[model samples]
Target chain A: MAKATSSAPPAGSHAAAPINQSLTPDDKIGLYRLMSRIRRFEQVSLQHYQGGKMAGFLHLYIGQESVAVGTISLLGENDHVITAYRDHAHALAVGMGMDECMAELFGKATGCSKGKGGSMHYFEPSKNYWGGHGIVAGQTPLGLGLAYGLKFKKLKGAALCYLGDGAVNQGAFHESLNLAALWSLPVIYIIENNGYSMGTSQSRSSAYPSCLAERAAGYDMDWELFSGEDIYEVRARTQVAIERAHTLSRPAVLEIATYRWEGHSVADANKEKYRTKEEVERFKNEHDPIQRWKRVLIEEGIASEEDLKKIDKEAQKEAEASGDFAKASPYPTPESIFEDVYWEVDNKTDAGQTGRHFFND
Target chain B: MPRRLSYRHALREAFDEELARDPMVVLMGEEVAQYNGAYKVTEGLWDKWGDDRIVDTPISEAGFIGMGIGASMLGVRPVMELMFWSFYTVAWDQIVNNAAMVRYMSGGKINCPIVIRGPANGGTGVGATHSHTPENILANFPGMKCVCPSNAYDAKGLMKAAIRDNDPVMFMESTKLYGEEWDVPSNDELPDGELFIPLGVADVKREGSDITLIAHGRAVITCLKAAEILEAEHGISAEVVDIRTIRPLDEETILESVAKTHRAIYVEENKPFCGVGAQIAYMIQSTIFDELDAPVLRINSLDAPAIYSPPLEAIQLPTPEVVVEKALSIC
Candidate 1:
């Protein structure tokens, strides 16, 4: 029941922080447009995946857009972000071009990863977006290391690492928690608990008292559970964690309760069998983050209905253009497979010249 | 001037020099810092470098290894120490998948300039679980550099090269040879003012005309011992070639040795099936079949889980006697 309203409880309740009321109208509208773009991009990617134009797994972030949008909006210049396979929303929020992301899905040479890394391995080092790792809980320690680098360099920055509900149970995640607390690394472990790990429901997969984030108590780290339906709430709550990380070099766990409209992945055929149709319908009708944020924008006089509709249409058009761009992009040359395997080899250093780097070569 | 130094001290000097050379280089592992390393390879490093550079982590291989890889991504040259290379499987995903493939996967936009070094041999009494020589397993992957130094000279030089290389270098050492002394040249004595032996190069320890014995790590020492026995008693001239870097293999040196000797035997401490020796044998026969006077044979550790009995384990690994027996048949 992720209901967002102006008349919710005060800041102290449920460890909730106050929203930044001083946001400019442009900033507020920008958040909406960001969410719309992510939603539309995911929809277009899903459409292509279903049409057999794409290969590999397609994990859509349609309903969970607000979590990525709100959490990423709070990042400063030094802050970094890394996430699990459901990574398109975060990639978009990190300012990676939709064209390159779409082209990566098409396995084209112009893609962000140069057509090497498909969907589960997008990395934008320039943007400080470390990756879209494939293995469960594999990115947890990596995220911790990002924070370690910042702390080592004495930089006042944090790394926001995202994972799914099922990932909370992995041994790597627990080990990361221990190291983060032990070293006081400034890493915010954000668990987008969409209630299912692939086909298994949250209860079937994890062992918990109330929610998953409280597992942070074992590591003596601060944690909070909140709803993802409200973009304002997401921003407000996540800001507190980020400030703690930046100021104190401490770690925190955030479990944002959200829902996905589709299956675990586009390849997941048991989408309807795992959960009830009524349950899915209810989440879409009521707990939809995009619709809730749209209403909030309209009610606050931030944007008119016509303005929101225009933004939505523009996002769709942008996503469609990205798809077209991906189609027009060329596939990587067969010989190019050996490229990018080693930095020394690619750069042609003395070390690269001494050995047989590629087996075929 | 050349001085006698043990393999352990040679490795420590490499760490000490690299940590001084680059501010980004860090050493992280269990018991590495205040504990002075599990095997004392990092004995005085903690006091010298302090907490920031030399870090002691919990017994979480997967966690810290992945952390090292992650830190390496952000311009940190992390040299991770596994107490035994056998424990590498606990962090398999981090070592093989993340560290090995990250550069290629990220399209060369990111590189994991990290080194994972530890003793990886089976001659010691540390039973099956603690006794895995996984150089072949790691060498099977692309974008990974595997170095198995056979002596103090190779250990020191190869280690420095591995630490500086812009790739994940799997530095495998041998506990049995860690304390053995070898004549290592001081930095001022070298032409480059540093003992930097480049990776993917082989050194011929002994010159011979009868047979070529290709080996790496501890097996090179074994081959040298066998060459002595063969020359003294059997009157056979067996050349010993140390292929220091296994992944970027020095195939040219190996081929040249085989071409001159016309008889070859691959030797290793790893199991026979799909071992590093297996790959060497395949390359020799596949490319230079005409040069070989006899089928290129191999003398490897007995193909079984490393046994617990001290006497049995001693016989299980390739000794000078076993190498002589294998070479006599081939020569």
Candidate 2:
């Protein structure tokens, strides 16, 4: 069972992982830098949300950084990426511009989706990042559709659909998973099982709360589980799943066990209300992804402690500069209110001219 | 003048033309491929386009419909067929929240070029669950286009236009009119993309001077039959105006007709509560109150579930006799 209060072993203290210095020096540094960027992006955005400079619900991906960092790093330029509202990490991982992402959260014109999408609805079709969907499991079917499109067009591309533990209970989740498997769609579904569905724990939410991967058999798809806290493990398992989708044109499900350092959203102010401070502090000390990866980089001799801090400083500066860029950007104009509602209809003229109640001729 | 074809066949021809014209155009729905469609509209399409283009999916409305929207977002022109339009209720969020809002939310970065085609009517006695005319519901979305065709010609013409449109379109067809034959042009006459009819434009099916019968879909045909009764039996010339597209509604055509006739009666198969007629009736009375000879009357289906009994079903829905009687009541 996904016993939230069960006496489980400490996260990183499970076993002393054999340090693998197998990767080249540049690849090691590059992967580490990518994680740093994602980490800084979420940190800077969380700061803005807490300071009341930004609006709307801001869900931080502080702890479960490796799942996004690991999986997105393996995707090709032609592939599509879609995920839930906690998507600041996914957007940065998919190579979306930092300034534009910050602008989007800032609700500025220069944002990838202008000011319309806000933070939760960030869309960059150019980069094939569909959007940061607001509703739970809302993008599951959409992701299947993207896969179906690729299959229809005979394109060598697949869609990466990311979901959370909460989304597993939604009807669209089962419906989409079944259809994708039945149609032999080119898609990979990654479940970031961070154990909490907002405030309600998975123990209360799901029937088989402990095992999301076990349910994939009913849909006739092979499933796997990975440690989301371990970046390399996430990458290795995800690479296998992606290869299955790319080569065999089959859908695969991988559940990554992770944790959220903060509350579900920035609005969930009382983080200590549901989770104990000891539990949060223990994970931070034991298996924090950033600390683990940094340790690996140093002990493996790929980069020195001083060298890692220099890279971290660069990522922090870049994230802070993007915040400055967002603050400097302007809001969308009022005339743009009637724009983009329809494809060819001139909403400014057409809506103003018709589709309303007029008292007189 | 060119050739006669059934409304269903005309729709299939439009699909055939678009599929041949563009490689991105594909058809998908339940029973659309191996079963050749529930109504035979997609009878031989699977044989022609094969599985790659003509995809048959299991009954998962929310899944496949949303998938179609996603595919359309990525530059595929998907014509997704729902067996009954009432089934759209299952995928309400996908249609209204996702597909309809994606383009606007994306700030016009992506266009959902999709057409959700199916028979949306109540005359076939498919019971309340299966038989629902959801044009008003579909038209309610600002980002979505709603197209209802009354004849083979309009079916062919508007299907062409809807497939070519760069936005999500709800192509409403009538189950009662699928087998009805009309002067639908041959491929030679229409050529590639020649029979395209602009959405939101109304057609004056039968011209008159006394009273106007504003209707759409099957109601357009009912109004035409009612016009014959009014002219022959009641000695009244009733003009039948077909409000083809309901979303970007043709107010100019409606206003001009009501202004000339000075009397109008709105007709539709949907319930009177928030029906298409209600909107048009509001437009007519509000805009041209001085020009009206009487209140713009609305003749719609009785506010109840569609019955399985044919007699009860006919009684609940608007028919030619009901429309004629309403026209005489106003005049």
Candidate 3:
């Protein structure tokens, strides 16, 4: 049941309506800062990994920062957020400080998961951002369950679940979508269409690859596909989806057509062997979200070139400070291993202790 | 002062009592509503609670399971029925990823107080796909508790405990034991409002000093029958221990029995390779390596797919004869 909003345009208007009212200069500046924060964080993380400071498989959210920041900005703090392993940006966007996130990646004791979970499993319940799950499509049902919990508890909030194009292949994704649609769970399933799923393009992976929004019809769901490169478009489309999710108490799918600027993980080289350099250059020149937004900011007088430079420098400094803090953080002791596995009353007592004989000697 | 009740009746009573106690409780699954549940465990629930609470889902395992997860997350205490335990593979993601990992992943902010109940273990020749005991597969996951009750008493206690538990629980009900009757405490004697059988506690069915025989679910009955034969014919006093919960195993009970008996034998309906029996064996070997007079023995189903034929299935799964032989060998 699509509600007839008075502001909605007549049918077949491909051009998205402006966000009802123009964003103020401060709003624009905030969006820019958020995106830059994600960008700089990923860049610094990559540098740290390359310098042998951060271990494990690092999936950078470099070129796709706009999608996470733009979509997450529309959500409130109480709302739940779940995403796949490419999760540093989602964590930061959901109010997780940079220091703790970087510290987790560095495997420090002060990390969000107390260094138990590395890059792929950064959990921070304080912000309601569920940890980054390593298994693909594993978070879908959990997201639906979270939404179910919210509705069951009568909480005034929704759950936003983000997955990659590759995850759609998993059975859990389809199963969760069917259930969410049937139950009308307050969940928004965002498919970050970053062209490929760990090197396999969507065309080769999905039987129908034109747009994921079309797949929603099978589940009797309403969907929207938007230019993920455009922050304004991402924001407007996600806001509509989120609003629908809240009002209808149902799940909606939003396909964000974005691209990853680097390899899937830290291992692969961005040689464009499978794809042509021309294709990469085309996206870089035409669809670079940061550059496009930077141009918009300068032309719209939201900020000057000097102001943008200062913002970039501040973001870099913040990222560098986070790296320093993570580097200075202590490694988790052997005692920390037994803790947090189960929330037991005697966990502290068992800490720094040796095994005890249960029977008489 | 216990009364005799069938496993199915005991489960139904548990559901009735729990629903009457907590308004947050509901049930959903295939054939659970109009059909009164595939195994009739929810016989009179639909008429009592109506459709809103007793939901009948389509033949979509993944869908309804996921929906149940969602509802549980929303603070609904949902008891999802999988019809048959083997079909759990269809919704493995929901069970493993969401239900099992939610509390740990959320850093204890969220707890999935949901119970996924289904008929597990082989009996009545349900054939290969319908008769495989997949508790071992579920036991591999962390944060999820697995309970397999062997009789009416345990069925009621374990079901009530699972519903009240804060973590997600995989409650495996044996199809063969549904009609079996046993002595169970009446509802009035139960804990006020709701009752709980604490997780990770073992029940010693029969006490002896010669050897400790450990089993769970359908195998508990098998081990009991074997214990009867071991005592009467072979003149061996074997202690039978029922492992009600698999994950947080009752290590204290097991180790205590092993220390006294000086020998142990595990009986399971699944394959031997990395089965629940293997875990028990490893724990015993690690904790009580010096206490054993002889090597710990295990009687498990052969590592092969269950066949549709009766003889083949019998050969694949553990039988009373097989358990008795293993216990005697351990002695």
Candidate 4:
């Protein structure tokens, strides 16, 4: 087992530090528990969808669990988070209850968005989770705007904006990067490079497949890349990027290299048509983050096989309970359709009014 | 108490007062600060407020306009100038997609409190690209509030209203009417402390029973002039209504005038097909179909683009003579 080091040596040092490190006992246990929860939650969600218990297109964060849990664990409750449509794991990682998230997937009244937003448009303002914007790269400007608002309010909070690598091709992405850099806004843009935008590979889609961080230089921003499979790497890199964003009130980008075990959506079967089965097996066997963490846990004396079994059992039970709660929750009433589309205060008009107050009527 | 001032001076005064009121408010455009604005509307702002408040950006319309959105998002109230309405094409993305939809698309999480001010319509010999009015294009956007002030009082009141409002406002200033002077009432006559002339409310510039002459922006002057000519020569008394805000659309005021006058003549500086005049005509036809004595007459610019040649440009846009002729024919 590799020992975890407190201080990371320079990249080109004569005595280079080893890449793989066993986490502390507590951290190993925590990592296994979080990954188990995410994996079980997503698997249960998939089963619910297959059973016709869930509605809408569910984009499961199965293979990419570490990226969400690892990075989000470093953020405080006061910090803001915004992401694209592939967002269930993000909502879960940010402390939204499993029942509420499951209810949202089931299109029930008890959902986080009151079942109005469905899968692609979840929002929990109380948690500082901005939204699950479906438009490719649409949330870039909005995330930048949120960072701008933080600066305007003189708050010492930073905003984390997550998007797929596919979203980087959009004009809003470029425009937002330029604007965010120009204004020195406190924002960290995390591009989750899962290698596929729907079905097209990143090589076929992007002109430059080297690293999204390379594009950050055009905006003159500090950038880094991390292996998404390694939770510690993601956590460490994100912490540094987010700390810099908050301290300097400037934007940074962190491109995470991850893979999706499931197909893009529930509709697509994992047939291995795009890539070979051997390739999928190679990643699943060699770089399966969940298994890698378990191995580290065993080496670090974090947990026994019995301890892992107990954690997985608890996760499965919790997921089942959440599914049951979601199933029992009622669908939104007809009148609920009109509500929450726009916020309504007791006596004040919404911002769009020409002159008349909203509640005056 | 009331004092007389030119439309240009009133606009400048509004900018000055708003800047004094809010430390975050800044003005940016080409020649706005150093060259005293494109039309002398910002003559003394540079000297008074210095470079920070009164900014002069490069001719990169897209860049500065985008910067305005960025700055506005950062809690600054930016009043951007586009020299002419025709030049708005260069910055349409920053305006339409970014500024207008940012609030709505963000699920009302943010408000873009920025004002884009510029001269629209042709009367000056600038010709073609510089002369064409593009208010209809801007009015088509859902989240934007479009305001075109014809007189000095409305100019000051509306500019103040826009600067203070929480939404993005497209404030269209007529290049031809900047020199036209009018009586601007003092604080006593103003509505409360807000001083905002409500958007989509038509001002009855002149009252007559013969016909209702509807116009907006620069065309309001043409309509008023035509109304005078009709009263003097043809004995046709025309009630001229200056439609200030185009989006919310004062259909109530217009319908009331059409019901009283029994005939209507809608004039606009844009193209004839599907212009603001067509919208007014549709509203009148739908609501007050029986009240109309004759079909709602629409006098608009030619369907083709405003040509560079003086004669062709003249033919394209509706002049006072054309408004007079159209009104007489309709009567």
The residue pairs in collision within model 2 are A145-B67
Query: Which candidate number maximizes TM-score?
Result: 1
Count clashing residue pairs per candidate. Answer: 0, 1, 6, 0
lDDT of 3 by residue, B1-331 (tens): 5778899999998888888889889888899999998889999999998976788887778767876776676579999998998899888877887777655554454557789998987756877788878888887876677888888888888888778776678999888889889987775765763445666678999999999999988888988888899999999988999988886667778899999999999888878888888888888989889999999889887877777788877777788788878777667
Candidate 2: where is the Cα deviation over 4 Å? A1-24, A346-361, B190-193
Off by over 4 Å in 1: A1-19
Q: What is the interface RMSD of candidate 2, in Å?
A: 2.9
Candidate 4 clashing pairs, residues 3+ apart or interchain: none
The alpha-carbon RMSD values of the candidates against the true structure, listed in the order shown, are 2.7, 4.2, 3.9, 5.5
> How would you encode candidate 2's per-residue C-alpha lDDT over A196-313 as one tens digit per residue?
8998887888887248865777788877766888776676667667777788888877789999998998889677787888988988889788888889778878799999999999
Residue-level lDDT of model 2, residues B231-250, one tens digit each, is 99989998889988887788
Worst 10 residues of 3 chain A by lDDT: A351-360
- Local accuracy by lDDT, each model: 0.90, 0.84, 0.80, 0.77
The residue ranges of model 4 lying beyond 4 angstroms of the native Cα positions read A1-60, A76-78, A97-118, A264-273, A294-299, A303-361, B1-9, B22-142, B175-181, B185-194, B272-274
Worst 10 residues of 2 chain B by lDDT: B185-194
Q: Rank the candidates by DockQ, best first.
A: 1, 2, 3, 4
